[model samples]
Target: MTRIESKLQRLSQIEATLVDHPEGITRAELARRFNVHRSTILRNLADLTIPVYEEGDRIFIDRESYLINLRLNIHEIIFIHLAGRLMTSNIDRQNPHAASTLRKLSTAIQGLAPQISQFVKGSANTFDNGSKKQDPHYMQVLEVLTSGWARNQKIHLWYHSQETGPIKEYIFSPFFIEVGAFGQTIYVIGRLDPDGTYRTFKIDRVERIELLTEKYAIPEDFNPDDLLNNAWGIWFTNQEPVTIELHFSWRVAQRVKETLWHPTQRLILQEDGSIIWQGEIAEPREMVPWIRGWGADVEVLQPESLREEIKNETIRFMNLYGIFAGSKENEK
Candidate 1:
């Protein structure tokens, strides 16, 4: 047999032994069982994700780390079910780990409350297109990124960036992984080596990635909450925060006031049932799409630039829908 096949068979044997013996077999015992040296056993275990605990001279696998029971309440179980359903859109449909996680949660909940399980089944039928069918290549990159993050290792990536106008090679010290809403792409948060600053990169845009031997230590001051405190979305900026005020018509005022949109958001209700919403943001670009989503029901009140842009957007919409002809008034 080839060396690769021998290694694969050894790894499979080690995993099976570890699973059967939760108390764990020692390094010497493992080496003896596999008919290999202690150094060879260590080498084989390096790539595995299993947690090892050393008590005296005996090294054993900590099974409790992988086998956890949260003992979730009904509401929490339902939330997990919904989140797992949503995650199906981001991850590949054939992803066994994600499928097993959802199935285990469903089974646990079904045993406790069969009625809720029935409701979940009925609700799941409504979302036939929930699985967005992610690219297998993207999934492979994500796996490497996750492993790099867990190991705190540096990764060399050939990334396609429009800003640089080339497929540039970068060494990144990845610290976090951000998965956006359902169907949205995944992003990697890392500190670029030469620049020594945090930047977010889309996972799918990475053309190539190679995990390096060097490891990195995350900064103590790295706080994602503080970094994204004033920004409207993912693009965190250090520029001065701008105050934005919007007036929502009475028709959509209640809907607008129902959710807390930002950390600095304030809402004032007028006597006519309209709402004056105000917030401070670092980047207005992210809010543009959300503002346009309201259409004629909302109007930007402060920040003349945003107001003008919204007016221009409305004019463009009118031109497309044939509401305004190619007339001088519409042009003005």
Candidate 2:
């Protein structure tokens, strides 16, 4: 390993050791454990960001200030394992920090939960193999955002908008980081500087980010859950909620009934085994792709505008495939 890489690894090890021994460990002991001099241990401790203190010759880290030390039961560990698996499967991008976190968790629980450790290790490997050629800047951008969020600081960033087809600069105060329900894509919700209008920016679209020293406070009324309460996905609006109704074919009725797709959703069963699903959503546009994913197994029954939009999209797809009304393909 390169010098910088080796130093970083050593620093991480020191932090982990400090967390494991919250009561305190002697500087001389840390130096002996890592086979380095006590001076080297002091330098590494200085580089650490966590709250570290010294009591005489022994070093200690504030467990309350450190977020890594967890006292989880077997069930909690299994739940975390499942969550790790889901994240590995859903996220298409490569995240080195995520892989490292899973690896560390796997190692930490290897003796207590051998089976789960293996699964978590497998998930970390998935990230490594899957992200060989992905975007290189994603991790760096995420790190800056995470730091800024944790410090309650503003960030100045250049954002590339797919819709606008241009790069724009914004000074933003990050209120929350959220993962979309449909794509599982990461987003940072915040207010634009000066104007202070709330906006959600996809992390992938962030071209450049610099954490600003200037800090900001989240509004007293700002609650991420409340902000996203009416959202179909990540797109919520100030307009009134639109009531959506969908009819599901009997073939997928049981599958549809297995989960509550939305908090406002209400389902009614028909005599023919078909199901009617209804919900109120702030932004219907985000649900379009999800609705289309069901193919012929579902139909949009209400909101004439949405129905028409879907109908038009279906017609376009039919035309693109050369499937005319009376064509053999359509008949099939």
Candidate 3:
């Protein structure tokens, strides 16, 4: 099996085993059960890539912590199983492993469906959380970042920024680490420049990484959190901080109050039923496309320069397909 195949299928089997045996299993038995070599089992647990472990000859699974850490519900577990299986079964699929895993996950509810459906009896409970440690390469990256703390020179990474095209390459130094979800978590906060600037890169979204042997000293006063704390998302560039005030109509007043748009956004309700949102941002231009998404539901109140920018954008959008103003055809 390929890496993707092994990753998901192994996790699915591990989950099923954890559900079956609460007390855990012997490393040798686990290897036999999976039909894989003992060395493979040893590598899986020792790798710490997917989250399995062993204590002495006996192995165990940390189910509670695993679920809590990843914030996965029962449905999600089932989904992962079904998906993994499908990927392995369907050779025609592009990412057959991914498809199989998803298929397994989709049918995971059925793993215990018989027990839940026409159950006139119950199975004795022997399931335990401490089974064995899983070794996944993705998890190893976290270990390297948190403890190893090794500055692996400069790395050329392929990253997706605008969310439109392919991941472009950039050379930067990774400094601080943020542990997030189960798989899609773990982001590196570092500076692209040697002068201690700030940048955040998601380890998962990173399509490629090549560490160079050339080492550059990280600035003495570098703080990635301080750099990212001021903005929202990972698009942090050194730009002039500007205040953006927006007026939201009462028609969608509940919308603004319901969701968080940015880290520094503050909402104040006015008597006219409209709400005023105030936020200090370093990149006003980045906010334009998003604010435009709200359309007439929002109106930029201050920073006339931004307003003009939006106006120009509005005109540009209107003319995209030769949209004529005040034309009956445009009314549609």
Candidate 4:
């Protein structure tokens, strides 16, 4: 086979393997599976023209393109286009920032979509929390997202998220939507367990957002209100609540007081002018450093247990690293 043809064939094989197993298949394993030397494997990687993520030695591919390439059947592509189009008008993808970001993305997914007719077939009305320009393409995404949300359905989405690592024959799934201040992002935040734990999968991060034909009925009692309310920041979870208390210096107290940390938070202003900020929390490990951002100006006053956890973590961090304070005594 010609050099280009060989790479194409091998790339197709890798795509098949991933289609069978979306979790991931490693590089060394890829070399072994194809009976190629490590060097040939490296060359194939370079010439394949597929994107992958590498953290140290582990390589992962999102499951997006798997089905698309597997079928190579026009009918399937047409179906994807039609289903994407049939989605109600309210479906929204995390609209990208108006910059080079969107430009790069629009360019990438150019050929990934099957056909325009599939999407535009069902007219999707467009409405949004932001400006309403009525972009036809954006309208398609909105329709798809809204359908996924309303039906409690899943979809295979094309997104860019942190988990996606190369071998891009593709993975796509539509499930939960990550809603943040800027807009909707390509992530599905849903329950991972019967006990009400949530795990989020990023849309673009994975190759495919395979919208399951099976519909999921959210238990009537599942209330995301508490879990969302207790978050320290964007990182959310359904973990148990921990009572965390923070003491703030007068200097930073006012600014901190004006904001709400959790819906359940209560503020007690001490006679000495210190503020005790107490709340039910989800994740303490992430919150400790934010508490320390005030330097010596803030203290963890309550939940003696959490104070100990913070103190131990602080000591461990200091021991593992070195720092230069502008202080003369420390310099000496």
Candidate 5:
């Protein structure tokens, strides 16, 4: 079943179990019933508004809250389920319990409709392929960031820096987490304490993080999207945004025009069915791989520096693949 379907189903199951066994369910029993670890069950319930309490050792979801239904129809529930699935699809890598959460929800609402259950089960099966295991340390860091953000607290981080050759310490006031539009990499954007200068840090690069009691107020004028006004991808430079122009042959014109390569991109259709793709970018190096992907069909038209860089890279590629340039041709 898809993650959302699984979550809904699991939630429905939990409600039914709680309702049936009104006295309470022990953590071990619940974990065994759900086929998840005790800790996973705890994490799954951490953010939920469900009233849970412990009597001696058994934990119980408040009967009062469980009896209060949302009165949602199957179609409405399915729409919400689909929305949750899309959200999970984007952040599944970062969120450890994303699948389990959806599973719980799916189980809770399974009997609402047989057709819905079948669809949810099918989707869950399709997306159930094994995913990459997350680093335990990374998960710890994520927890610290999440907690700090929720409480408006600051964080002290010991982050590994490859360029700097050592771990660096910084006091960061995390304003928000940013994920790639296509959901590639995740980032934490915040201001360095004391300096108050904004910076973006890769979540994976964080070696260790500690949540501090010191509170911080996010700048009222802060805007995350503006930070990427000139970025081609994730790497941002302080250099002035340069106008980049590319001419694509008619063969790839439609393909080029269809994609929004950058936020500042503009496409000009030529009479010959070719396309002139133009955009402003802060870092030209980031665009190298993309430009090279089109092979000989795309040509850099402006920003002499970028054009030269591409030309140099092409020559390097030709030299690397001597079959195309001829190894002995240089000697001749």
Candidate 6:
């Protein structure tokens, strides 16, 4: 490895060791463990961002003060492993921070959960291998936005909106960062300057970002969970929540009832062995694609507008597939 790469690796190891051993390890022991000189260990320790203190000949990091020092039980570790696996599988882009997090988690639980640690390590390796290249500006934009959020500072960024078909500039104060449950797309919810109107911006659409000196505070009434309480996904609308009722054919009733699809979901078993599913959400448009995925097995039972929309969409699909409406082929 190059000298810089070696140094960075050593620094990471030193931090991990300190975190793992709250009682601390001697500088001499650290040098021996890594096969480096004592001076090199000291220099590397100084480069660490975590707060570390020397107690006699030993150096220690206070677990309470360390943000990454997690004490998880075996079950919790498994949960984290599964979540990380799902995240890595869904996000097909190179994210150095995510890889680093997986590596650190692997190191933290290697002794207690060796099998899970191996899987986590393998996931990190996949990211490091760069199987897919991310947008060139993604990392930079994410870092700037994260910094701005942490410091309560405003940010100026150039954003490209697919819906509006233009590149617009906004001065924003970030309130929260959220990932869409369905698509795994990361978004920032915040307020725009001057008008102070709340908006959500997708991170990938950010072309450039700059941290501004101006600072702002999140509103007292601004609760992210409350904002998304009735949302189907990341979309929030001022329209009143609507009750959505869907009927599932008996063929898919068992599969439909296997999981809780939403917080407000209620399932009613029918005498015919089919299922009736109902839920309340602010925006019905966000659920259209999921509704379509069920094809003929599911039908929208309420909201005539939404039912008509689905009927129209199905007609379009039929036409696209060279099948005419009211065709005998569909009956067969």
TM-score of every prediction relative to native: 0.72, 0.79, 0.46, 0.44, 0.66, 0.77
Rank order by lDDT, top first?
2, 6, 1, 5, 3, 4
Residues 224-322, model 6: lDDT tens digits:
998888888888887788999999999999999999888889999999999999999888888998899998999999888899999999889888988
Candidate 4 Cα errors over 4 Å, as ranges: 1-146, 155-176, 180-187, 192-197, 202-204, 234-239, 302-332
The per-model lDDT (C-alpha) reads: 0.77, 0.86, 0.61, 0.56, 0.74, 0.85
**Model 4 per-residue lDDT tens digits across residues 110-139:** 477534432332222222224334344553
Evaluation by lDDT, superior candidate among 2 and 6: 2
Better of 1 and 2 by lDDT: 2
lDDT (Cα, tens digit) per residue for candidate 1, span 247-298: 9999998788789899999999999999999999887767898898897789
All candidates in order of TM-score, best leading: 2, 6, 1, 5, 3, 4
Over the full model, what C-alpha lDDT does candidate 1 score relative to the true structure? 0.77
Residue 104 deviation, candidate 2, in Å? Answer: 1.8
Compared with the true structure, the alpha-carbon lDDT of candidate 6 equals 0.85
Off by more than 4 A, model 5: 1-94, 108-129, 181-183, 237-239, 324-332
lDDT of 3 at 248: 92
What tens digits encode model 3's per-residue C-alpha lDDT throughout 215-322?
655677776666665454444567666788999999989978998887788999999989999988776766776788788788888788998898788788889978
lDDT of candidate model 2 versus the reference: 0.86
Best by TM-score: 2
How many clashing pairs per prediction, in order?
0, 0, 47, 48, 28, 0
Q: After superposing candidate 3, which stretches have Cα over 4 Å from the reference?
A: 1-171, 177-188, 193-208, 212-223, 237-240, 328-332
Off by over 4 Å in 2: 1-67, 131-133
Specify the poorest-scoring 10-residue window by lDDT in model 1.
123-132
